[model samples]
Target: MERKRSNRGRWTSVATAVIWIGTTGGASGHEIKVLASQLLTAPGSRDTVYLSWGHIVPVDMPIDAETIKDYRLHTPSGSVNYLSTEGTSLHANVVTVDEEGLYTAEVIRHPSIYTLVIDETGHRHATGSKVEAAKLGGTVDYSARSHQFAKALLISGDAHEGSTKVLGHEFEIVPLDGPESWVAGSDLRVRVLFQGKPAARQDVFARYIGFKPDQAWCFAIPTDNDGIATIRVDRAGTWIIRAQKTLPAALEDRALFDLESYTASVALEVLP
Candidate 1:
């Protein structure tokens, strides 16, 4: 199939509508996510997928191609297709749908180590090397190796089985039910998985477009022992649900970092 180019003005409008619902898991630092021009579309239509990276909003943050470990599309037919990317300014790619079903756009970022040091003199320094921060004779306020995963859903005609397919991402959020009919005041059932197993007792945060900018999230819920979280769809608009897992570093890695963290997010659209 021939690739399509996304119009800058069209993307600007779609991006403006979903920026309110964008998320980057952690309280500090930038996070990456995938967003589409539209969640619902017709057969033979094209959708522009954006790999957005930023703190809380989906601004035009330029992403280094090397940082993107993987970017692909999972089609309704179960075929995996790699995206031919274009435009680093938005990190955008376009995909076309010829049949009717749901498609998933997924992205994985290379694991990166980050540390924050607060010296005795009350000055803070941020660096990618924890060992370097330790040599400053300062307090390691935060030190963790981060793994990020993101996904966005696009429906061509109707929602289908692809929504529940486990794509084998180290950390992922899977919708238990189809999102084709999600609407305001409804409840969305989702599962958090880590290393192909259910991630039990995890914290999940969610927000919708137009939510309060000062607030971290509009809804906060924890997964049950089965890794299930029932998020109440508060209002109509684009919505994103994110989850994070943090663990103490292994004995060998302790010398380099204090903790390892995994974060995952999924974007959905809810009708009024």
Candidate 2:
């Protein structure tokens, strides 16, 4: 049997826990975010990105491991298949860029159910479900998650090459246009797209990670009819933006919480 790597070794970082969108995203329907080594990275450099179920939020215990059915590095020409291994916590894949275009990373975790129960009585549960009536029972029924994340990396000396491309993902967020690099006082414009069109009136969030890895500043804005949400970056650092659509649960489970969520995000850096 293959020795499954511990969740801590999943992403190659100890500080891999993250919680996006304040209290709104309560570990329900999720968005797969790509945390790049650095948003403003040089071309041909070793860039490793992690596919996290939630944002860069601190999560206790080990995150439930879900097999990444489709992990691809997308470009205008086509996509390159990524060999993702199992037993790894967060599916962190590394990519090398030679041509400067729109590099979009797509991560898909097929439907799964994650349940956490306090097992103080030394009862080991094999499944991701609550055992009997354990105190503090939490469940996350994750439907098929299709998350598309894009980062514009124009090398230090090169012109834009590839055209803006979309892989026809369901829940997606595309950086329309803005300054090449964001500063302290800058506004970011992102289109909330669902199935190739704009998603109107949805809540979007941007979590800015400052110099201190332990702290972050969060901002929330709503998308307009055009499916665009503009938010100001008050500080300079790394920003992981996420937005989603929600609906009532198809089948209610009395033991679990209510509702389903679908999310998309931009995992990159904002210059100071």
Candidate 3:
């Protein structure tokens, strides 16, 4: 049997842990994010991008390839490339850029049900159905239909013409600034959108690549009425920005779950 890597790691550095926790409001779980080794590359460079589930650590746990409902690469010339990884391990997709413009990689996952139940003995269980867990003498603690969307920004050269365009995600975090704004000590602004409109007062979370795995995020802030959140690019490295929105389940879905969750994450590289 292939041994599974333990998802929980120790907080070896107290100072790092304290700083991250203080800014991020403590660590949480179940974050879906896109993963890439390098985002800024030259033309004809091949980049392998993967999807990780259950944590914001860009390369945490690779999800099953079958879970991907859509994978696409949007180009600066307004062309879209449909990508697939049928024969690859864990369905990781690879892209080779031939143009000198900003490229966006988007991945949409199939919706799934996640449920937590607490039994009489006070033990918690993870199940797929809240109704079934309730019948099994377990009190339903939380249940939701989780929908995840992930994106990564890759710049081939200096052409950043389409860096600020919306890609039509159901729930999205669009970077309003271009690669020029990704410098350390600069303010990188992003807007959250839900159903194609501004998502006001949305909570946005971010962290750099070297952040400890035991921490939740390096920074946390909420968007203003215009749905814009300003994140300080404090370091010159890869960063992941994430946001989530949850709503009550539809009438028909109420029996299966209590709510619906939509999560979005964007990964990019920052220069010093």
Question: Which one is best on lDDT?
Answer: 1
> In candidate 3, which residue pairs get closer than 3 Å at backbone N, Cα or C atoms, i.e. clash?
none
- Tell me how candidate 2 scores on lDDT: 0.52
Over 1-272, each residue of candidate 2 has an lDDT whose tens digit, in order, gives: 12233322322221222334234444443345545565555556667655555434422122334545566666434656564646756656666765554455666556444332334454222233333323444333332212234332222223253223455667777666633535565667778888788999987766665423432225666799999887666556667676767665555443442334466666545567
How do all the candidates rank in terms of lDDT, highest first? Answer: 1, 3, 2
Task: Report the lDDT of model 1 for residue 212.
Answer: 52
TM-score of 2: 0.66
- If the candidates were sorted by their TM-score against the true structure, best first, what order would they fall in? 3, 1, 2
Summarize candidate 3's per-residue lDDT along 1-272 as a digit string, tens digits.
Answer: 11121111112223433565555331123555666667888888888776666653655555666777888888877799887756424456777788888888888988877776777677454547687777777778767788888888887788555346788889999999888778776678999999999999988877787776545566667799999998876668888888888899998989898888888989988889
Give each prediction's root-mean-square deviation over alpha carbons: 9.3, 10.9, 7.9
Candidate 1, RMSD to the unseen true structure: 9.3
TM-score against truth, every candidate: 0.83, 0.66, 0.84
Local accuracy of candidate 1 as per-residue lDDT tens digits, 126-154: 65768877776777876788899999877
Native-to-model Cα distance after best TM-score fit, residue 162 in candidate 3, in Å: 6.9
Better of 1 and 2 by TM-score: 1
Clashes of 2: 7
Clashes of each: 0, 7, 0
